[model samples]
Target chain A: MPKFLIWIAALAALIALPHGLSFSQQEILVFLTINVLLVASYRLLTLTGEWSLGHVVIMGVGAYSSALLTKKLGVYVPVSMLLGGVIAALIAVLLSFPLFRMKGFYFLIGSFAAGEIIRLLWKRFRDPFGGAKGIKGIDPMPDFSVGFYQFDFFEPTSYYYFAGVVVAVCLWILWRIEKSPVGLTFHAVHWQDKLAQASGVNVRAYRTLAFAIASGFAGISGALLAHYVGTINPNAFDIDLMVFVLTWAIVGGTATFYGPILGCVVLTVINEVVLRELGLEQMRPLIYGAIMILSILFLPNGLESIVQKLTKRRAAGGAPERSPAE
Target chain B: MLDLLAQTGLNAVYAASYISLVAVGLVLIFGVMGVINFAHGELFMAGAYAIVALYAGLNVPFFLAVAAGLLFVGCLGLLMEKALFRPLKDNPLGGLVASIGFLMILQALAVMGFGVRMVHIPPVTQEVIAFSEKVRLPVARLYVIIAAIVLLSALWYFLKRTKFGWALRASAQDPEAAALQGISITQTARIAMFIGAGLAGIAGALTAPLVSVNPHMGHSVIVTAFIVIIVGGVGSLEGAIVASVAYALVHTFVTTFWDGVLADIVGLSLMLLVLIVKPTGLFGSADRA
Candidate 1:
């Protein structure tokens, strides 16, 4: 019952959180909400023990598809977002045919190559992808109203609330997937693919499944960003952005479901709030790099390990219970 | 048409020289340390910056600036070994992550020290060698080619003939057995890191005059090196050189005939094809992958 109340309180805080921030911080909050989805989806792919360098490109796939569908095909903004995710997933499946042939290091490089090819295609073709400048004047999510409150697409707070709900539902689905039997198979395949294969689990199929699902969610996050930002370019989803995602996942420690999300939130706080306040915008990458190195060296288990210790200490005097949500 | 082809061939040879230098460094570091040095491109960038500061800014002698670039970037490699790679020795991924962090730091340093714009370095020479009426190779490019041949041959000699070279190769083959045989992994790692980084540094320094020197310039160098190393086989030095030549020939010819973007696509597609057809690379043994 107490845990349930805690969940309610957390939800309430998230819902009300953007109201207090300045216009810019509220904008950051919206981006933070979308990034939580991006990093969380990234964690899903990592569950199968393969790190992909092309995840941001897959996200770009979503952004491009969503923007194009609405502009060219006259699809509704919301429906186009879903279709964008589906297309991203389909692309992942196709990439897996060439990518899954190798494992470990080879997989990393191959995925990068595949992603670069996709980006190059986007750059080479000016017709659909708008060449290097990418698509501009993207359709925004149409505002709607309920009895209690009206959503204004122009306001960051409204977008924040809408994105928050969508991301929350997505996170719930991801959490459920991680807890299911398929999730266990992902873990099995990661730890020992041959053993998993011997036990009747199709290793490659599970890997592809994880990759597809992860790409699907990443695509959704990209769509959310596109509608909000109203513009994107090929450079928007370059390796630099991918590096941020990679650092978030690694620095957050991928042992637990919430690790990467926690990493994303904390790092975003540091990068956006603290550094911006300090007027250290130019030194942001330097400081962030230092933080990544320090965390890996000293806090290899990540911030979650710290959270676990605090929770464990509090629970020492009481009966042990598994947390309902990971 | 024949003149254009001849000129393109000369351009490919010059491209091959610098690319092999960078790719061989990457291969050497991966061979000895079992970690992909993501900061390698930044090290190459640092080398260019060294020449920028010394030769361009301070008006230092050109060859002296090149040597200083090699030593400076090589020392940076040692620093990475001591501060980052050494502690994270057991975890290859951790080392890679740390190298990425280091890469960011290097790039930030470059940006802070020299703003984001392209740095214009004065020409080292004005002489161009004329093979024919239509074919020409600049003296600066000749410097790069000569340096590549000499440095690579020296490296080959050190690896095949020297005691330290033998120790390095043995450890690369099997760290456990090498350790059992009383080989010092730390010593070999340092030496390999130095030589590998020095090679990349020199490549950058030698080419700094030929290309636009900028902080982000390493991006393309690293990408080309990756394609070359992967196509040549991950752990093979000779394969890296051969692959570098082949890739340069294809890329240069394509760029000459078609657009640069299509050339990039073709090069990347060739890499993908090799990856799909033979995951171990063209010359790599199966065990390495």
Candidate 2:
């Protein structure tokens, strides 16, 4: 099958997905859709050779910003969500000044400290942030109808469809950005900043750009989550969620764009569907931990490496294979 | 106001003691192995739970339980070295991920074995030392402070005077050079892991009666430790200790005057400031990070 046909088929499957699932699963699907965007955005940041522990908190910045906009300022829900992304991007630009000074482990810890400060701010200020309990009863996406279908917002399927379209478009933009010259600069920056700089690449500017754009998408994802979940809290964007994102990126392998998405989807299925159905709620973390360790130990290159290997083997007997841009 | 300040100062000292213990261990592990043990906090929790099992559940003597906590958690560190860190030695990122996995496993084990509820251990002593009418220090807090000083001083002596200590420091400073000098990297790694994990364990064991013990308790512990280590400068033991004291004083005073959340913000902001101004930390050199 050609690439376009494969994409169309995947889109059709995604469109048809929630209809076959139970109500709770439909809700999970909506979340999964949002997380795909979240992880994909995180990949963009990693493209510039930096892993931010603050990414989830930046997502929270979006959720909190959008939630506050809608709840306090009475802005339109959709407009607030977009503004939320913009605000998150703005915050990333500001944070980049202090954060981009450090590299490697220092950057990791620096980002984490930056994120904690934000979360602590949320907990300290109850006036607008609603204190530790966070903003509750966030406005949902207003119900609307297209010619062929109605979106009730109350129904998970409807929310899934709404979120799915937004995520698909966001993913497309992210894909385009990754394939552009800027993306190549990001890769160059990742591999060797000095070389990229010598070759006339503005390393810092590209790093900041990737950070801002990734943060923007993450914010949008957070906004989608806030509306669907009907609430937002400091705890919601805590380090645990960050760890999950990190796990997704690592387990799926960050070598390719689809890697983290594949990891997120697969892990979500196992965690939500398999573990939940097995009634092993208590043991979920235990099993997940084991899986993480096993994968790192045995499949250090990630699940994507396996996929890459299989694809390479298949393509070996065919025409010469082109290396992935990644 | 003076009395309150004094009391808060005493509290800060107590806080600094445990924080430094944890931070030092973390720094030690990172220095030698070149991987941050995300599970360090969980190791502390394990130490607390060891007390819960031995002292609270089985009626062991408090001091003996504390000792057992140290040894048991130290052995757990050896297990980590043999199983996780040693195998993934070449891959620091992999080691980090593995430590995270170990952290989750330890937390889950705690939840399963002891339930998610907080466990309370009986106080070994109810005595409070009164500096003044309002300025008082609990005897238990003094125990932590004393242990921190004695252990740190002894560690200093060992590092300066002992061959193994020299070996450990040598490996931490430059692993290949240390190995070329006939020091076994594996042995030094084991020693560092043992001491590092032991320090955190002992901190948890000493403070078990003072703080609420639970599976998720490690979360905040880890956060505070991270802030301390970052502010102290990564891979610098002296820096970790000094930063822990500085952070504790600032945090304790902030929490006293303002609130707990603000204290956390202040601590984190202090770290960010250090990163921005001196990315190597207050006492750190540029090469370590």
* TM (chain A), candidate 1: 0.96
Model 2, stretches more than 4 Å misplaced?
A1-4, A317-326
- Which tens-of-lDDT digit does each residue in B132-203 have in candidate 1? 899999999999999999999999999999999999999888888899999999999999999999999999
lDDT of 2 by residue, A223-277 (tens): 9999999989999999999999999998998888899999999999998999999
Model 1 has a DockQ score of: 0.59
Give the whole-model CA lDDT for all candidates, comma-separated: 0.92, 0.91
- lDDT per residue, candidate 2, B1-289, as tens digits? 9999889999999999999999999998988888889999999999999989999999999889999999999999999999899888777778888999999999999999999999978988999999899999999999999999999999888887999999988998888999999999999989889999999999999999999999999989999998888888888889999999998999999999988888888888888998888888877776554
What lDDT score goes with residue A288 in model 1?
Answer: 90
Itemize residue pairs with steric clashes in candidate 1.
none
